[model samples]
Target: MKQFFRLMAALFLSLVLSLAGLAPPAAARGKAPERIPTILISIDGFRPDYISPALTPNLAAIAAKGVSGTMTPSFPTITFPNHWTLATGLRPDRHGVINGAMSDPAHPGVIFGKSSEQPWWWDGSGGPVHVEPIWVAAERAHIRSGIMFWPGSTTAIDGIRASDWQAYHADLPNHERAEVVLDWMRRPANIRPGLALLYFGDVDVNGHRHGPGSPETTAAIRDVDAAIGYLRRGLAGMHRQVNLVIVSDHGMAHTIPDHVIWLKDYVAKEDYALVSYGGILFINNVPGHEAKLAESLKKMPAFIHCWGKGELPERFHYGRNPRVPDWLCLPDPGARIMDGNPEHPNDGGDHGYDPASPDMRALFLATGPAFRSGTHLPVFDNVSIEPLLRRLIGLAPGKDRDGTVAPVEKALR
Candidate 1:
């Protein structure tokens, strides 16, 4: 009789402790209620139009339960720069990830995309340029983060790796990506990640090869949506609510081989390094040729619009960064620049244009416990995403952060 009484007393005490959250159940120990688990997915090259019900049923379903809207990419809407901007919430001018292919005078030989092997160019310590990523804010608050294939994740934050992250892997299948995320969530609560970023390149890849409107691109978008569904099922199996945000770095636009500009006609090869991305170019002029080169490039106004370092449009928040080349150009829609005879496919699509242009707008869709169902927001800037994530995860944002939640808070419950 005494033993039975003792067992009852112990059970009561356990219940009291658990109720107070002083002692979590074995299954939930060390997990934080204040820190929500969030999965941020970036589908490269997924334009807003790519999310129609006919093409992306899964995304539409998520939109029905969450907020969906157009998201404008930062200026010079290319991959690496805009992806980094999404992570840091700062424009390329501040983060110093100037373009897909760029040279930072501060970090000699450390190119942004091609020189990933160099740590100084990527890790936060690599600065004078590498800005603080939003993940670092989560980490400072004792939250663990996991990243799979998100740009800028490979670099260390304050000399420490993202709680865990992987270098880019082209061969990792979409299903495996979903399973990996599920596995991460299944870890013991103490070691489980509170934030995760997943990336898919298929939509962008198809857009570049087959053009954004091609049936092949349609098929790719559907495949990506299927992957999203796979991730949803996996998250549900965990029996825990997870916030999901799907975004794209930039949209895609059609391009034809005939619309190309050959640069060798106007300048010597050594005089400048021509970094072209569909409609944008970062021209690093040799010391003596800044003025002449800018002038020469301007002569082709029929094909490109050249701007001096300080001449970049204010809306872009670019050009001031030292990494910005001596000259910047935005080619006309459907145009591209090359050295002699560049070797890209005859026809496909590209994105590196003015962000305000319709072709440069990316997709934004999110669903989670803290958000209102069926919310649809007016078009918002991609810079606004960082604040939304910070708020959803129970963190106070820095006053100086580049994003504003006011525009997106309408979607919050």
Candidate 2:
């Protein structure tokens, strides 16, 4: 009996040893290394095709050593909506940021961004973001975050902790923006944020000012590229092993000056107010005139489609956001929405169209220890970005949402 007991004990010991061998290492026990200390850089209005040996050397170098692909922004393909979508990992409908300007039919005086004091924009201070952003998720997990000029970040969310953030401003120089980001990364507390978002607006601004592919746009792209190069070198000098994910809100297309559409021309100015940005036009018509204005916009030559607040394209996934206008008009590719008044001339290029258009498809590049080198993945929804960011920072998403969008696994080394 004693010999039998010894044999049983030995067997148990062997099984325990085997199980321990299969267990994950201490560093690898929780999440993939590729998911930590991630940096997402947004170069506004960056087109995938803009990446060439001639135009963007630094981006090319990163792409050569990492993964590159087209990342489709959320529907309506505008900046504010897509940028918010990227942070929330929810469709515009879910997040309620349908467009740059939105009108709340339920609340008589509620208009987002029509005037500075309007309470229409997402109130991060107390309001709930249907899906928690990676920043909030990271903060919940005791991780620090840093955001520089990312839209929607200016409004502080309840649980999200960011070292610093700024409201969206097209006028901020690219180099100055980079410097701010680097300073945040170098914070003495080793506050090198687990997640850092850097945005460069020159490309989009120049694209709107001089038209995409024009000399001014090209120069802006080069200038931003050089800034990125500086950032890359700076990060390396700091010996930070970060996963850099470069992305763009949307791309631009040249618009013919003659094809401009002025909403006031087709609708009574008294009944409707036009809120325009990034080539998206939102007409807030008086309650009774909503239908008439919608119809007129549909018949307009420059507009590709017009929809009532709830009838925006299924693909747009907008309408639900508090910021979406009551009546949304999408101009076709290479079209501009402008006031026909002689004072306001139609010039430059724009992007607020369907994101699927190649012209609106943006650039996405990922590099670092977490990303596989020299690879390309199929296009993905911009909303998937939040999930990847959460994983990198070792945090869980706030809400259990439709999990259709996941991290870019292909980018993992």
Candidate 3:
């Protein structure tokens, strides 16, 4: 009878300690640790230099505790392309989001837009094919994902959307976005998302309107930092093991009104259809006028460089996609390429520049049980991010991924 009472007492004590989180974790008892949740946070148009203890304390704190580095964005250094690259481990050329706006020959009169969720716009399923994104891969592996306004998240890539997703709403406040992610994180383990994405676009917006160095952009940075602090607090309260990976699609560069390059000034509007314009210009030649258009572009100022579709610099790894127009023209750093004259020719800042430009480098900071503490890594291509994410979520690197885990594996424990 005494032995039975002692056994009961011991069991009761164990239950109490476990309930209080004071007992040895499963790992201590020779069981593997629970799967660590992975959260990817994107700060659009964020440059590595933008992070400092005074400007972004929360991000600074995370950097001090984990891995921090700069990521070279895919060629064109545009938001949509680099985001897709980070999510798919494929370059803009391979992933098909070659530019923020592009046209496909099969879809006549249809130009890809920001809010378009058509799988064809992403994977060319309406034409070329579907290249899977990370969320789709996660779902395929039986892992749930919560996507909060990531580009392509709402779309049915591989005929699968994330288990939970919110449509892109530019009006949505940053804190509210963080709250949605926290709510998702709070779900019971059985239903909780193993992989999630949170995106904040205010920095990009402000950077476009007020320049990367403007006070307005600085305020936006602070606002995002506060939201990060809120998310960190929420995660701590939940006592959930999470790997938080913060990144940016591309960095911003200052642009002035005089810096704008008017496309019509170099090429006749009648000779080609301008599919897209900005720092990079995509022009589809009018039938039978290709040679004339090519000849005219040769007179372009030294600031702009034009290339026939398949003839782009091999280093860019672009122009092969049919969606990329016949002629691709890239302007010098800090210059804008406009299809036509606009009342406001210049924004305060812009991306879409050469990825090699210093101002176009994106941000990378990661912290969690899966990462080495206080680690700083060299600049790596943004494509490598997807492989790292796959590793974090316990997924195997499948076939045809452009990024290798080698660049980022050093930051892992």
Best-matching candidate per TM-score: 3
Candidate with top lDDT is 3
Model 3 ranges with Cα > 4 A deviation: 1-33, 124-130, 341-343
Please tell me which model should have the higher lDDT, number 1 or number 2. Answer: 1
Q: Candidate 3 local accuracy as lDDT?
A: 0.88
Provide the overall lDDT of each model, using Cα atoms, as 2-decimal numbers: 0.79, 0.73, 0.88
Clashes of 3: 0
Encode model 2's per-residue lDDT on 312-393: one tens digit a residue.
6666656755555667777778766666453435777888877778899988898887778888889887777777776666
Candidate 3 has what TM-score?
A: 0.90
Q: Each model's number of backbone clashes?
A: 0, 6, 0
Expressed as tens digits, the lDDT of each residue in 123-241 for candidate 3 is 74443335888999999999999999998888897679999999888999899999999999899887899999999999998998888889999999999999999999999999977
Give the residue spans of candidate 1 off by over 4 A: 1-35, 114-130, 268-270
TM-score of each: 0.87, 0.82, 0.90
* lDDT at residue 319 of model 1 (Cα atoms): 78
Ranked candidates, highest lDDT first? 3, 1, 2
Give the per-residue lDDT digits (tens) of candidate 1, residues 1-413: 99999999999999987888865568877645545599899999998887767778899888777888888898779888888778877777776677788776866765666436455444334334456777877888888889898877877756666788888887888878877888888887789888888999998989988888899999889988998898898778778688888999999988867777677776667678765545677777788866677667756747678787898778888777667787877887668766655456357888888888788888888898877889888888888888887887777875566678888888887
Clashing pairs in 2: 35-392, 96-321, 96-322, 97-321, 102-323, 102-324
